[model samples]
Structure formats: structure tokens, C-alpha cells
Target chain A: MTTITQGHAAQDHAHDSHGPARGLSRWLFTTNHKDIGTLYLLFALVMLFVGGGMALVIRAELFQPGLQFVNPEFFNQMTTMHALIMVFGMIMPAFVGFANWMIPMMIGAPDMALPRLNNWSFWILPFAGTILLSTLFMDGGGPAAGWTLYPPLVLQSGNSLAFAIFAVHLLGMSSILGAINIIVTVMNMRAPGMTLLKMPMFVWTWLITAYLLILVMPVLAGGVTMLLTDRFFGTSFFQAAGGGDPVLFQHIFWFFGHPEVYIIILPSFGIISQIIPTFSRKPLFGYSSMVYATAGIAFLSCIVWAHHMFTVGMPLAGQMFFMMSTMLIAIPTAVKVFNWTATMWRGSLSFETPMLFAIAFLFLFSIGGFSGVMMAIAPVDFQYHDTYFIVAHFHYVLVPGALFAAIGGAYFWLPKWTGHMYDETLGKIHFWLSAVGVNLTFFPQHFLGLAGMPRRIPDYATQFADWNAVSSVGAFLFGFSQLMFVYIVVKCIRGGKQATAQVWDNPEGLEWTVPSPAPYHTFDEAPLIK
Target chain B: MTTRQDIDPELQRRIRRNALMVGGFALLIFVLYIVAVALKVAG
Candidate 1:
């Protein structure tokens, strides 16, 4: 790979004719990858705050368990909307933002293969998000059926259900289009010497993730469309009165849903892989094995969907099959964790803010993974299913696991994106508050779940009050700490110390070969990787 | 430095072909899902 050098001055001058167009049209109509990436990141940030606010409402109501803030119905709406917004609106788009910004650059291409399609993919999100959020003000309020949108209970929702379903269809379209773009770009656009194996981990994971999306997103769209028909068109796809089976809905939803977990996390594994090697100042351990492990995890994810519905009742042999399949996922997941840990072993480790978050992810995501394994047992999940333990498990995975890696990736790349260094001192402060606040908020929920305090309730038994209160306090601390992150990002973008071309020491990839704050149009001429 | 035109024509054709195939497959999955669900409900 080419080393970072200050040779882009002449190229920058040559590309001035193709610099960003003036004003709003630059963002609206242009297909430049960097501009589109900025749009995705900014949109995800807004959704993060919007979703985080709903979470605070949930916590405040559960602070003492007597419906302190909102009615039970509205509280259910909050829970439902929170998961939907976080999963669909925030996390997925943020990774797409990363893919948009880095993939073309890493592979030494000018832009996504389908640039207009890229534009369309991003433009769809805001409208979809607006339709979703607008449901809160509808006559009967937003979708209260949880993000899963299981039938029967979901069918009981009012007019907002149709609007919510429409919004989901739009969101799925955006993902499908976006995934197609990534797959095409990665398959087609690599530089002359950049073989598939030599491509960065981020690109490889996303390639796998893009395939997973293409496969499962259509299933989700179909499932929700069935929900729509059942409610409106008098179809009984999930309604028992018309001889339809509700359990079938669970089977369909979790088919998309389980892989959806891997969908959210596989790119996070990619991000951590990139960050750990850079900070540790060593080549990634077992590079080929890591690739195989990711593919293994993706394949296993498709088969293990039934594990989520063990409590719904299946034959014993069926239960055993799902249980064993779910357990098998642990092998590949363990390989990734082992590879990350082995990457850091006896290396020149430093705790910069990004590295700090990566380390925290390694520790905390494992906690979530272990909880996942515990629940994988068909018998044990009967007790744990739909409890706060399930909540704790996913929150640990998403919040610290996926979310932390995104933050670490942002910090790692912010300098390259903005051409200015973020305030390191403040970044550290953000990390510690977040690290402490996330743990304090989530750890006790494990106890609450084990203690039989169910999830999605407005009120609970008196015995569960203490941990609930503690978890609430931690929630606010974590929520407010994110504002510091926003501040640091804005501060960096506005300007600080001007960064060198290689912002971090000896980070590998074609992205670093370009100038800092990479030019509006990069690699109009592809670089030979070797 | 190789511009888009400078790249091999055969490679570009392959890229176009692959993209069409992938996009078609996604559309097929979506339509197939609706069909399968419809058949199940009808039965």
C-alpha cells in the first residue's frame, strides 16, 4: 500500500474545477460520497437525540414505578418508538454513513458505483423518519406494538399503524438500495493491486453485512406488509379468527430479526478490528480467520432465528435444533473476540479516546454476548424471554457493543474528515462519563430481569424499585454525556489544530493516502494499491 | 493515475453485469416473499 505523503497538493489544484457546488444544491443533488456521508451522519445524530429523549421518558416513568410522568399507553408508545428510532433511524444509518465516507476512499474509487442511487437512498431517510415521528401526534398516537410489530396485538393499533407500516416500507427500500450500492461498489471499484483479501476489515465486514441486508430486509418488508393487510384488507395472515396463525408471525419476524442483530453488529466488529490494530501498533492477528469467522457468524445468524421464539412453543426436537444452532454462533463470535484480544496482547497499547471506547466495547460487548449464550438454552429462555434480562442483553450489545464502536470510529476518523483535531481532553471526559454511565444504567437491569421484573411495564412491584431508580440516574447521566460528544464533534468541524495527512500514526489503508479533509472528488484517477 | 475510461473495458462490463444481477436478485427475493406468504395464507 502507498504510504501517506503530502503529494496531494498538485492533485488538489487539478481537482478545483470539480470542487463542491455552491449552496444547498451541493447537498440535495450532488452525488459526491463525502457530502452524502456528512448528510447521513448529521441525520443519524438528530435521530440519536430524538430517540435518546424517548429513552429518558421511559426511565423517568420507571424511576419509582407509579407512572410518574406519562400514561401507560404513551409509555408503551415511548418504548416502541425508542426501539424503532434507535434501530432503524440511528444505528443503521450511522454505519451507512461510515460506509459512504470510507469505502470509496479505502478502495481507491472516485465515488459509489451508483451515485444517483446513493443520493436517492439518503434522501428517502428524512421523509421516512418524519412520517414515523409524525405518528406521535396522530389521533391514537404512534405504534405501540414494539419494533417487532408482532401481529394480533399490533393489529389493535389505530390509524397510525398504517402510517407506521408505510414508513417501515420506505425505510426498508432505503436499506435495500443502499446495500445494493455498497455491494456493487466493493465488487467493482477496488484499485488494481488491492486484492479481495488485502482490502481493509471495514470493507470486508460491510460486504458481508450488505449481503445480509439484501437477504433479510425484504423479509421484514413482507412481514410488515402482511401486518398492514391483516389490519386493513381483512386478511388473516396473522389473525386466528380467519384461520391464520399468530405464531407464524413470530417465526417470520425473528427470521429477519435475529440476523438483524448481526446486521447491526458485524460492522462494529469491523470498526473495532481496524481501531485495535492501529492503536496496538501491530498487524491484525489471524486476519484470514477473522474473515472466515465473520462469514460463519452471518451464516449461523440466518438459522438461529427460532431461538428467539423458544417460549412460543415448538416440538422438543425443534427446540433442540434452535438451541444448538444458536449455541453454534458462539464459536465464530468467540474467534472475533479472541482475535481482538490477541491483537492487543503485548503490543504498544495507548488509551486515546477511540482506543478507550474500543477497549470498553471489548469488555462490555462480551458481557452482552455471555448473556446471549445463557439465554440460548431453550429451557432457560422460557424464564428469561421478554424479561428485563433480554432487555439487558440487547442493550448491552447495542449500546456498548454497536454504539460504542461507532463512536470510536467517528473519533478515529473525525480528524481525517474535518482536517482538524478534536479536543483530546474533552474526548476523554466524554468517554469516561459514557463508560461509567452505560454500565451503571445497564448492569442492574440484569438483576431486575432475574428478579422477575418484566420489560415494557409502566409500573412494577415495590421490590424492583431500587435498581430501577439507580438505572434511571445512570440513564440521565449517559444521555446528558452524549451532548458533550455533539459539542466535541462540532468544535472539531469548526476548526482546531490543523491535522497532517496521516492523522493517526501509521494507520493502514488507501484512505490515508489522500490529503486530510479529503478533496470533494477523490481518486478521479485510481491509485495503484501495490 | 487511471481515470474511468482508462480502466479495462472488460472489467467495467463485468461491474455492470454484476450490479444488475445483484439488484435483480434483491427484487426477486421481495416478490418471492410476497408470493410465498400469499400462498401460505390462501392455503
Candidate 2:
């Protein structure tokens, strides 16, 4: 036994002596969590541009309406591709990137419990994304039935249908594997004194999010796979001609879809939770309650899937159940909003870029949340369903809600990642532009929708024309402003003011204990979390 | 010089076991979904 132990110890020592490998091979083959984290972040960044370019196509076409740029088919393709790429390719992976970089460190684990699985999880994404994007070039332009891929219409989508389904399967598999790794690492690998309750909010949020992923991703896979078979294998799961119900597809899709929204937002909640307290220079107010609120949100997310399908003509009972459950989600979400406010109340607050973004997320996400409550009224939804009002509502949630939190997270941690401070002036400029651009882009759509303009169209009535034009201009400004964010990140990485290990003034976490630009490998020995 | 083997063996076993359980649970849900769909088609 002693001999075997010595041999294992020697192997570990040798492993520790090496740093990252040279060149592209390092990223391609690395099992290091930090390397994988960097790969996920970079990949998400590239996809953001790819996805954003698609948004620009959408906005430019909508600039003056009347099909100014692409055909209607292509316009539908842009909206479809934009949502798929942003949700799966950009936002999900970006949060996963943060998890990879921060989770083990926060919990004081040596590395992910399943390091090889982490590498596989990230590598699967690019190939999956490639398959999905390549569909746009297929004989029939991409999956144009919106990201929902509602059947019958989706069934008619050209050769891209099978490829897109396969891509969804791959994406689902990747998420499941990543989720498993996170659960195992958090459950089994926390440093000795880091009890579950004692974990940082980011780690707790991710733990819950991972469980959400494991539960919901498989359902999406099954739904898409059923779609694949219906298209090619003579199955009629959603084909009305064969007595299969079309509404059933909506049921299945939203069962996965609604939780997927929380999957996207919950991590942002975690990020904001971390930022608000830090800027406030206070221990997180209501830390335990914050954790419970997150769990409450996740639980509520599962029951509220039917809320998205209110227009599908469910029985009044079903609609009432879904509406009430969705409204209940507001209780926990409001608790969170209140906690963040309380954390900042009269504490010597400073508005660094991260805090600025978090503050924007607070007010704007509330706007989104209030709009969501408006839609949750089953009676109100009949009027608002599928209108640009719905469009405005979610963009408020996602752009400022999820996307801003993500950008804020990046700012919060960029100094640690690069060992250099990003240009503060440029970050604030980026923030203002993004804030202004987002409101200008989506806020007008509310007016247009109320005026009876439907979504996913290439042209609009002249009465709706004014808001659409303003929205288009806002989209351009928002699109161009993101370029500055890219520049800020790149500039910080290349060179800037040096950062200390703490990065911020006495932030509370094990991560702050490590050197800035956190070494290639960390926590080889598990930290005792006293 | 700590290698994977240097970590506490019992903890390692627990991690591996729990990971498999989670992975298995996800796969089970996927399989069950497909089975339900198949049953519906047959019916």
C-alpha cells in the first residue's frame, strides 16, 4: 500500500511541474478547468458576434420595413437563427464558462471532479454549433419556424430540419454532461469547511442551475427527436393528419422552454447577487434567503411552463393554474429584487462598471418582470399574445436581465482573469450605449405591439412604421456598442493597470485569495474553508 | 505531487458514484420520454 501511494504521489508531482502546453493543441486537448473555461468564454464571444450579426440583419431589414434587405423567408430565418444561437450558443455557454472558472475555486476544489468530462462538454459545443449554423446554408434556409420549431411549419422546413434536430440533440447531451460534472463537483468536492449553506451565491446558483439543466435538457432532446422522426420516419407525433395533436408539440416544447428561460436567468441572478453585495461593501444581506429564493424560482420555473401556451386554448382551469403559478414566481423573484436593494441600502456603494450593469439589471429587469406579470393574466395574454409587446417583454428580460448580468459578471471578474484592469471609461461608455440602445430598440416595440403589430414579419403597416424605425435605429446602436465591449476585453488581456490578488476591495470568497490571472492550475490541495 | 489517487479514495468513489447516478437519471428521463412517445404512436 505504501509503495502504491508513493507512486501515485510521484505521478501527481510530475503533473504539477508542467504548465499549459504550447499553441492550439493546449486548448484542443487540455483537461485543465481554467483552460476549458477560457475556451468556453472565447467560443461564446465568437458566437455572440455571429448571433449579433444575425440580429443586425434583422434590424437592418426592419429599418424601414417593406422587406428592405432580405426576403421574408430569410427574415424568418434570421429571427429563428438569432434566438437559437443566442440561447444555446452564446448565453448558456457564457454562464457555463463562468461556472467552469469560478465554481471549483469558490468551493476550494482542486479541479472539477470530472475534468475529462468538462473538456468533452465544451468541445461538443463548437461542433454542435457548426451543424446548427450550417443549416442556414442548406437548400432551404435555416429552421425558420422560430426557435420554438413548432411543428407542421417546422416539418416543412427544408433539409435543415434533420441537421437542426441532430444539433439540438448534441447540445442537449453537452449540457447534460456539464450538468453532471457540476453536481458531482459541488456535492462531493467542496473544501472541508465549506458547508452547502456557506458556499458563495454564485456556486449555489450554479448548483441549482445544473439540476435544472439535467432535468429539462433531456425533455428538449426528446421533443426534437420526436420532431425528427415525424419529419422522416413516418411518425405522426405532431401531425394532425395522423390524429397527432399539434398543440401537444407546444406542450412538450414549452415544458422544456419555460424552464430554459430560468436556466438562462438564474445564473445571472447569482452574478448580480455577488456584485450587489460587493459594491455595497457589505456581507450579502439575507444570504440564506437569497439561496431559498433561487431554489423557489427554480421550482416555480418547472410548474410555469404552461403559461407560455395560454393562447393554445387550454381549459380555463389549466390556464388559471398556469397563470397563478407563474404569478407566484413573482414572490420569490421579488424577494431577490428586494434583497439586492437591501444589500445596497445605505452601504458605502461604488459604481464600478459591474455595479453599474447590476443597477441597470435591477430596474430594467423589474420592468421586464412587471411586463411579464401583465402577460401572465390569461385575459391580458389574448390581446398581447405574439405581438411585439411579447417581443419587448422578453428582450427586456434577456438583454438587460440576463445579458447585462453576464456582461457585468465579465467585468466583475475580468481583472482576476487577466491580472489587469479594463479601461474604466470605456466600460462605462459601453454600459451607457448598451443601456440606451437596448431601451430604444425594444421599448418602442411595446407601442407598436399595442397598436396591433404582430411579430416575426418582414413588413409593417405605416401606423406601426414609426416605432419600428426607431427600434431599428436602436438596434443598430446596440449592435455597434457591443464592439466596444469586445475591445475592452481584448485591451485588458493584452495590457493594462496591474491587478492585485484581491482585485476588488476585500471581496468575500476563496477566489479572491488566489493570485490575479489565477494560475494555470489552482487548489491542487483542497482548501480548508475556515 | 498529489495525483488523482492521492485524493481520499472514499471521496473519489462517492464522486464517481454520484456522477453516474446523475448521468443515469438524465438518460432515464430521455429514454422514458421516447418510450412515452412510442406508446402514443402505437396507440
Instruction: Please name the candidate that would achieve the greatest DockQ relative to the true structure.
Output: 1
The C-alpha stretches of model 2 lying farther than 4 A from their native spots are A1-15, B1-5
lDDT (tens digit, per residue) of candidate 1 on A24-135: 9999997888888999999999999999999999999999968688998999999999999999999999999999999999888878887888999999999999999999
Can you tell me which runs of candidate 1 are displaced by over 4 Å? A1-13, B1-13
Cα lDDT of model 2 by residue, A1-530, tens digit:
00001111111233467888999999989988888988999999999999999998988888785778799999999999999999999999999999999998787777899999999999999999999999989997789999999988999988789998898899888889999999999998877667899898989899999999999898888889889989999888989998777787888888889999999999999999889988999988898898999999999999989888888889999999999999999999999999999999999899999999999999999999999999999999999999999999999999999999999999999998999999999999999999999999999989988888999998887788788889989999998999999999999999999999889987888777777888776666655555
Looking at model 2, the pairs that clash are A13-B1
Best by TM-score, which number? 1
Residue A140, candidate 1: Cα error in Å is 0.6
What's model 1's lDDT at A529?
56
Q: Which lDDT values do the candidates have, in the order given? A: 0.90, 0.89
Model 2's CAPRI class is medium
TM-score, per-candidate, Cα-based: 0.97, 0.96
